[model samples]
Target: MSTSPRGRLVVAAVLFPLILASCTIDPSTGPVAISSATSSGVSLPGATFPSGAPSPTTASSPTVDTSRTTGSSAPSSPTLPSTTAVPAPRIRTSPADGADGISPTAPVTVRAQAGTFLRVALTNPEGRPVTGAFSAGRTVWTSTEPLGYRRKYTLTAGAVRPGAPRTESTSSFTTLSPLQTIYPSFFPNPTMKTVGVGQPMVIIFDKAPVDRVAAEKALSVKTVPAVKGSWFWWDDRTVHYRPSTHWKPGTEVTVSANLYGVHLGGGSYGEADRSMSVTIGPSRIATIDDATKQMQVFVDGRKVKTFPVSMGMDKEVTVAGQKISFVTPSGTYVAQEKYEVKQMSSASYGLPVNSSLGYDSRIPLAMRFSDGGIFVHAAPWSVADQGVRNVSHGCINLGPAAGRWFYDNFGHGDVMTVKGTSTRLDPSDGFGDWNISWDKWLAGSALA
Candidate 1:
């Protein structure tokens, strides 16, 4: 159609915008599209124009997109990763699998690795918790005594390893009729320490304790002015309390043995509380060394007298140790002084006389070694062999002068020591004092 110049120009500008939109836009029928409004009207780019229009042209479609489009295309929705949670741990094995009808008297136990603070509870058929007669320790928990006769017990325990999620474990135990009544081991039993200057306080128990380590801890002792001391467990049933050194003269000493209700081994228990007082007497310590063949007496840490003495032969040397043990079985015998110049016969002595183990002495001396054949008699023949040379069977020989000195000075409880030799002290041999250090002695104890 024919038109004025100004109107024609306006139409040309509008046409230019519509054609440009068609080139850059996408088709709405396919994956994407763009729409624009102009004076001519709304126009859809990247799509077919109206048929028979002033200009009709077909354009190629955009490459189809398989992946979903984002902004400026279709809508986009947020996505979240899949998720799940972990569970807790549980016990794997228990007492056992199905067995048979079990006895009710049997004891039940629960155990686990350390640091698992487990709370255990037992309940009856009616769901009531059995609370009394229960005990527990660092590694174990058990009934203080036997459980009720022929009773059904349900136990539940809950525990958690450090930093682990809390978990629970449970089991059931049926006890048969009571066959034994095991008593509970009790603590904090009463204690008594002896306090006397001359007393060696001792604790005597009816039952030997099984755990000496624990029992010793229960005992306590202290002097008015504290002294160094230790516990000597004579046996499981008895313990002696003594100072490292003897008590100082005139010092007051007290000792106690705290043992009660502790289950000593062999189905026994400790006796009543024990306390003793001791009064230290004058210092009396004697040392008899085979070396130099002299006996030195000491009082209050000062030497007093020295005496010459005879000793056992190499075949029967005195034991080697600090103290001299007089393990002689006490008995009496008449002193026999005679001259047996001729080779003595075994038949000369009364009781199964064996001259082999005894010296055929002519000068009589009464000696005491064993009850059967014991005597401390004169050995004038052994005078030259005293000291330097090891001679005279097991009996100690003495010179006439020194013998009389010892005979006159000696009294009951007067210190006597015999040391130096190759013989080892026999455990049952009582002839030794200070034979071993207290620690070494304690090491030999079964209690240790």
Candidate 2:
């Protein structure tokens, strides 16, 4: 509509103020309608916009400013590179980051969520790889065996999303150091081919272990025939195993000391693992009755022969006003060593051979059992007392005929059981393990 210059000026002034308030001009984005709240896709140059929203544009439609648009025909914002859909999973480790004083047996584990484990590498400070296993789903890895004490270990784990690069994470920890370490020294000495069926397996420790329960639990025994047996502690430093009855002849037995990594007690742990196997020989047993003054021999459960013998003195009153008796100890024993002719003297038992009550002689047919100087040997001097009275030192005195027979027929590892003596065999004396009752034996077990 044509209007005078003064009327046109008035209309331009009112409309220009309103238009200026609604639309704003910018150097980078050309123009935009300013609002109290931001437009859904509107943003400055190089500024990031939220997902599902477009970038800032001129007043026509929301579009990115690839170049300043002077008209309504602005092109669609250059399709933003497709946003990352899902991030790769992260790795997490046990003994998180840098830990210390870990147990040697505790597992070092790595796991992932919303992803799968690609690699799990655990190594010692020297970079030696530790052995481990992966879970069925491959989402976790754990150590298979025990770690070393006072050692530093490093762990690195990698995880990946379905189509993402592997992401790695690392951690480290140290195991606790033991205050001490122990090892077992058990018998049949690891060399004997055959042992008496009555012989018990004995384990002697270098020192008393701190945790007897753990130490005992670490030991095991397996017989080829699988006979039932149990372990008993004779003392803090020693343990023994035996069947309910004597082992069967020709039975093969194996003993394992799986002490390594076992916590022994206090701060002590086991040092190493050990194993031994032995065989049981023929069954041969000898029974002696101090009251009857006789020795009965048995072979393979059959009674063989009997011989008249003399045992230790009932009592002897000495000049020092001391009543001393050379009573033989009564208990089960094994013939450990044999001698065709062994020199016998009071000096061997810490007595003066020259003394009036002592004698020195070369005794024939000696089978020694007790660690003390006790033996079943020929003592012809006491022949008159044989089968009648107790008249020798602690030796089981036999006639020349009987002694020679035993020396020729009795083999090493044969059993000998003494009865009716007032002096009981000490559990630690010779092979007197059978003297203890089964219940008493079991009571000594740490597990009990």
Per-residue alpha-carbon lDDT of candidate 2 for residues 152-261, written as tens digits (9 for 90 to 100): 77665555655433455655666667788887887887887788778889888998997788888889999988888889887789899998778899999999888776
lDDT per residue for candidate 1 within 1-448, as digits (tens), equals 8899999999999999676554433222223111110001011111111111110001111111111111122122223222231122232212221212222222333333332324555455555444322234322233222233334455554434432344444445443222222222211122322211212345655445666665676577777667776666555566555565556666766555543333333433333335555445556554556777765766667887765656656652222332322222211111112121223322333312332453343444343322223233355666787656656544556676655554444322233445665554442232122344667655643445
lDDT of 2 at 166: 42
| lDDT over C-alpha atoms for residue 12 of model 1 | 97
What is the C-alpha local distance difference test score of each model?
Answer: 0.40, 0.70
- Counting only residues 3 or more apart in sequence or on different chains, how many pairs clash (N, Cα, C under 3 Å) in candidate 1? 38
Q: Highest TM-score among the candidates is held by which one? A: 2
Highest lDDT model number: 2
Worst 10 residues of 2 by lDDT: 53-62
Q: Tell me the TM-score of each prediction against the true structure.
A: 0.39, 0.71
